[model samples]
Target: MASLLPFQDLNCFPNPHTAISNATDPINVGPTPSSRTCFPTLVPKLEPLDDLFEPQEQEQALGNIISTPNPENASANACAGIPQGVPMEDHVYSEFNRISQMFWAAFPDNVQQSGDDNVSNSDSRAIVPVPKENTQVSSVVVATRKRSSQRVKELVRVGDIRIEDERHHRAVVRRTRMVYDSLRILTPMEEKKSSDDSAKRKRPRGDTRAAAMLRYRGMWLNRDKRIVGAIPGIHVGDLFLYRMELLVVGLHCQTQAGIDYLPASMSPNKEPIATSVIVSGGYEDDIDDGDVIIYTGHGGQDAKHSKQVAHQKLEGGNLALERSMQYGVEVRVIRGIKHEGSASSSNKVYVYDGLYRIAACWFELGKSGFGVYKYKLLRIDGQEKLGSAILKHARLLRVDPIFSDSTSCFSLDISLNKENTPVRLFNDIDADDGPLHFEYLTRTSFPHFVFHQSGSATGCECVESCTDGCFCALKNGNEFPYNRNGILLRGKPVVFECGPFCRCPPHCQNRVTQKGMKVRLEVFRSRETATGWGVRSLDVIHAGAFICEYTGVVLTTGQAQILTMNGDSMVYPNRFPDRWAEWGDLSQIYPNYMRPSYPSIPPLDFALDVSTMRNVACYIRRSAAPNVFVQFVLYDHNNLMFPHLMLFAMETIPPLRELSLDYGVADDCTGKLLICN
Candidate 1:
């Protein structure tokens, strides 16, 4: 019988097999007892992606194995049978899986022994999966299939001229997001330094002022080109949390100035024209009437932005607004309003309200009894609904749920009052036919086999909330993983959140994902093609904001397989694509800079059974270009073997937009049918 015990060397392992050394060559070992062809203890190195290599070069790279002589060996036979045009990584993983299956099949006694142990300990309680020794190797081998099949389709369709404008806009938007993500990291560091010296100055700097100035000095902006109409890649409903973000994306140029304009030397008519303006209700005399905005031009305002300090003049930005109105040029209008959910009163959310034309300009007496330049800006026609208006409406709906059609809602609070915010269930397409009968689950339910031995717990000892240098924060590279605004600073392989063992209160900043449902969400019928039921936020969800956790009954791979064979659908969390690289592409621009780390976890041989009981996340469908992404988080449980599957918004999702995830190939392309793009 083949030995299943651990061994230091491949040769020591009781298996007569050949070891594959590299991608092209296969080393042969003498045949032994069973007909099964066992592989080396170590897995073969994955091949480079074809996109990184030219076609001719890629063919040349694979030529040695395809054209080389094949001898009477299992490895040689497998290498020779590799079909042309197939992805190199796909073949490697396929062979690796075959070897693993054969190896396990050869040891029937060990398999039965492990199966019996799991069966004897099985219970209905939620518990961690048993930690396996070779899980890391299997996880790494499976993790390479990160991009969705839709991404492959997109790559093929990129050359089409019909979508050239769209392609260009997507590239610009991607780069802009990258710049913004990078700035999020840099701004906090700069702010910390500024805060240390804040006492020395009479007027302390705003949140991102110092950082914006530094980025300007470094010229770390998307582009210097200024344009008049709608800026490429920026959508009307796009939201920003900082003024620095607007600067990085080239939507605005000034670090402190509200009005951004092109000088007369750059304008076609040799006259200064306003390009964009921010209306933060800074002037008491300003009126915001949805489509029409009475904007207050820069100057004559005190440092506090409350009242005018001097008489207004028609020059600089004031003159630019007048010229724009006279020349019939459009101006981008952004609205800055206080984030209702933020604890800090200074925190504001900026919304791009689309192109607007200056209709009239005049000097008006402000509320402070002083003259101030005022400009009436009218929103352009045929644009999407205003994002700010949607947010205001959503706020009202939350206060009085009855304001909406109560009959359309199948269930008002699907969480059964478990979550702090109520999750509504609505079905307008059909006659209030709610989802099939399923018990509501707020958290993951693990099997009873998870070993729970009493051990000394390790955690932070913060009195109120965790701070930098705490145990939990230290585990995350000695820095708080979340910003003061509760946004994740950067995506990592794994996020360590404060658990019950920690002395900090439940509201600790370190426990971000643990806080259930920060945004109001609802289950709605999707009108989009091929989409059935979908989840959407009732309020604006910022990028990196924790939406909800994938909660359901967790089962071992063995249990899941039996259930699958018995016609039960299962969700393999490990098989979800790793698209965290989309968060930022700074490495493409700066060679030394590293891309945002994708959440990497070991291949968890477990599946979530959501048929009987599941959360709202189950309703979220899959998409190639998804607005949400799965993140591996550990907080309530101590098992690295099984982390909670948490979903976070990959980008700013406008209210009522369907939430989708990039569900890469199910089983990581291990010959299983593709579940989603």
Candidate 2:
């Protein structure tokens, strides 16, 4: 009942049975014909390859065939028909047989023969029916084949994913584990103890007893013995306990320490103690003492020397003496005695002879042909016995019971005789006769109406001495210029005093210049010299002593220039008498006293015109050998616009000596010595 077709008309190759039957003679198959193929009656219409096996069924059949050991069974499984319950179609069977034959032909070496007759024909067919709900079943065969091919290609390329030799990796892992284990081995208590030991090693260790002693200004205090170690670098101005014993420690030169030759074994709690063996010879390259008071001198030089002698060079020692004269360097006078007996019996004693400041030092050739080092020290005032008393008396003299009011006049002492006899006023002198048309300002009062004070209204309220905290003293480095003897310290500037608003008492040490003139001075007319006026001192004036001030009208440069052009001279015009015709011009007589002319005028901001009415300062004559010079000063005021012109003694002047000042001239006025008969 089925249509028959030629063997060439089939869609696939011949069956495996046919191929095995004619093994010797191979039949070459061609393309399928259009006409139907002739075959046995049991054979039905052959269906298409897709109709015979779905994609899912084909994938399963292929997996089973590859896994099966028998070649006949694998071929049968790959070409299996429909599900078990469904009737088999002749066309489906024929198509399956063709495909199996072709698969076996393609891989003939993989095929195997099996002799199992008990295996059912249906069981041999491994194909199963695909579920109707599985819509993606068509792509299953392609996806599986692709995945298999990819796996094969990857294995061929990479060989294996895991590392082949893991010995190095294992070693690294073992070392890391050992490090972690070592870190965790220490306990918290052990770690803390180790840290504490490290801190102990870093801390400094010293004698416990010495560490317990109090330290002040670099000196260690031994409270039990009431003694202090005088380590190096101790300063002169520094203050220490009044009654403590000083143990002088030696420097680079010597290790031996003893007090001047007196007994050092005994303790003295009453008076302050000191040590001998003054250290010397430590000079740095810069030749400066680092601004400290300490300085070194020639070791073998005699301690006793005159005040004027300053410079000396050493025979064999460091050149530390070269810088001893540096200004402001403090000097310590250590007095001691040296012992001559054995070390056990011998004792040295030392004492402090007050403090002194270095004034000068130098190197000079000595009698021994070698250079000797010399230094000159000025005794500090408050430290010396006599100096301290003089300062106390000076402060007492400054107090005024009469002028209790703030605006009251200052006290003035006028004397006629050398014994300092008081007089009310001068007889011949007239205020109108002076060149400047201004009233003279005596020590009695200031010209308060013309110039206003410039500093803060609040004044210092120091009781006796002005400390460093005092407003007036703080402005001037906490130092009062005038000494106990009422003498101004050399090389100091104009100092200010506490103002009326100050709370300090009238007798406060800070009120030196404000107390007015202390020495006796007089203004006199000279008939012999053409310079009609001159000032003289009745009492002896020491060097660096304060003198009277030069007071006049304070005018600006513009105002002064106008007055000069209008024939108003700033200074008194020189008048030479006929008897002094041989002296030529007044400028030649006093060559140092040259005044500014019209052509080359001086550039001064403020000029004090003493031409019309002036003080006794205008009468002070010019001399080649002068003893005083003018200094700029500010009292309780701070107005720098018009500072006061004050005069101070440059050198010592004896009684009845005519006071004079150098006019700063270029020519030598000392050349012509005149003898008055």
Candidate 3:
């Protein structure tokens, strides 16, 4: 036997492979028994994936090997292989497998071990075959059959193994085969970073105002509900009250600047739907922001019934609805609650959904004022069920006496058109069905209540006037926010976000901007220099398109710094992130109200004008050209855009020399030219 141990003792330990100066390199033990003692060497190598042996077992006896099925007698070869200390002509292959034992542990499933063997051709065997699992392959490396030997090189990720070094390719294979009967690749191990260490990294401190204000460095709301632009240099998640109307809550928008923007870059198709709402129960209010028992249609306007109840509850007690006369529908209400501080203290919340087996619990809600909730229409198989649901608990005021106390409601607010939902309304739900489905939304600011009465079918089309500031949205059989201009109550604007006559334009993006309105924007700045040259061009021209807009902002190279999450401070009035640059050409001007910083980088008011009536021609970019005469027009009128004077295009861009306007605006045409071409 190859020496029981490498040293003098009987214990099996490695000889401390001296050749492994760099752990990445494979150790090569020569084909000499005296030099390679089988004293159970430390395992570092793994089996090559493409070996002659079966993926999980040694098909033959201890002394034998496995091979691919031959063209003839496939079944014969399955049992014909030799075994047991049987030294065959393929000794080189046997020796190769012997070397593989030193490094097999790296493979997870290569655990089949061989017992002592004798030099025999055939012997008894114990084998269990297991299907091979594919290696956790790298995205870059694809497997191919031609490179059979190369599989061994991929088996090792030892500290010393240099992936690109081809010298150990053969030895790596020999050692791998000797160790494992099975193998598989693992996913790349990710090095985790501790939160403390991340926090310790140095960063460019946030801005000066960030330290002073503590709250203004980002978008926030004030007490009055208006928006206060961010204060320049604060941390994320900090909440601060802005100019009264709006509050600013820090989000990770700046921190996650480079995050994945597309969420559903991959998905499948959608399914169709039918009617959504199953009108369960409803009641009308007797009082109308007043104290009078009027006719409640649910009770069919009983004067004697109404007067008896109004007199009974005059002292304040309870309004209970437990019988079928109160509501005529079935539902599964998972939650319910009673109205607090009601005129009647004992008003019990009756939930009818659970009384009848219909659908799952989607939502249940009720506030002191208007009770609200939502429901998702579940599609089982391909059928859409209109299960009428009712509020287990709600407290809505209907002016006072009649139906004010028992009103429960909800709305559907979604971008339904984009979702391709089918909605339909029906007269009798049990009758022949149509294609329309009902979708509802809620605009809570309006404070209106919505009732899902037993016979109310919705129209097929979903609501469309949904944009910024609009309260309502519709989706597949469900509703969203309760908007001001949404659902109708007694035929009036819910809360009147925009005055009736001031309705927003159909294509407008905000609730504020409407048709025929000119919003004025103003800025406060101190005057600097009186004037600057307009343009110097190589050729003169008559009036046509004079590049009318002004280029007001210019950045510098040292100032053209790119900001990263680290080493950079945040900006305040946080607008115009796209306009930031180190050094470049001219950029356009935004209003002072739109400026992010308190004191903005100076605006160029200087322009060329000959008449000296203090005529201000907008600043155009600067340049040096021979024939391009840049002229400034003078006007006696106060308006800067109209009633102008002189004209010129003074800047000339030579052949290959690229050009751009350095600073301001162009000359205006006053209709009468002061100088002829």
Q: Regarding TM-score, does 1 or 3 come out ahead?
A: 1
Candidate 1 minimal-lDDT segment of 10 residues? 150-159
Q: Give lDDT tens digits, candidate 2, residues 1-677.
A: 01111111122223323323433311121112232233221211111121112334423322322111232232221223122333334222222222222110111122233453112122121111122243121211100001221111000001112332223322222222222211112122123435654464322111111111111111221111111212112222211110112321111111122112111122111111221223222211012221222233333333233111222222122222211122121334442222121011113222234444444433323333333333434455544342222222322323432222322212233222212222112224333222222355443223463346563556676767666567776655555545444544423334566667777777776566556666656554455333454666644454556677665666656766787775444531111111111111123112373332212112225655655545566667765435566544566566544445567765434333467765443244322211010
Q: Which candidate is the best by lDDT?
A: 1
User: All predictions: root-mean-square deviation over Cα?
Assistant: 28.9, 52.8, 36.2
> In model 1, what lDDT does residue 567 have?
54
lDDT of 1 by residue, 1-677 (tens): 11122211212222221211111211112222333332322211121121122334323423332121322222322222334454535432232232222110111122234542421121111111212232211111000011221111000001112354544555556544645554554455546746764465332223243333323233222232244556546778777766556765667755446787755543322355677888877666678888987777676665544666655555667777766565455678888877664322356777888878666554434566555556777787789889788778677777876577777778888878888788888876777444546777877887654426213468899998887688887767677767766776666767888888899987788888887778898888767624357888888777777899988789988888887775555788877777655554344334597754433456778888876788788777776667888878887666666778888877767677678887665334322321122
Per-model C-alpha lDDT, please?
A: 0.58, 0.33, 0.18
Q: How many Å off is the CA of 637 in candidate 2?
A: 0.9
TM-score of 1: 0.66
- In terms of lDDT, model 1 sits at 0.58
Ordered from best to worst lDDT, the candidate numbers read 1, 2, 3
Q: Native-vs-model 2 lDDT? A: 0.33
TM-score of each: 0.66, 0.31, 0.12
Find the 10 residues in a row with the least total lDDT in model 2.
150-159
Residue-wise lDDT of candidate 3 within 1-677, one digit each (tens)?
11011112212222224212222311111122233233331111121111112322322111112222232333321222222243444322233233233221222122233455221111111111111131111101110111222111111111223333222342332122111100100000011112355566432211111111112111111111100111112211111111101111111111101110101111000000010111112212221111111111111122322211211110000111111101111111211123221111223121111122112111111111111111111122221121111111111111221142212111111213311221111121123211112122111011011122211232222134444333321211122111232111111101112222223344322122112111111111112212211221111111111212121112222331442123322111112121112011111111132212211222222221212111112222222111122212111111112211112111112111111232221233211212100
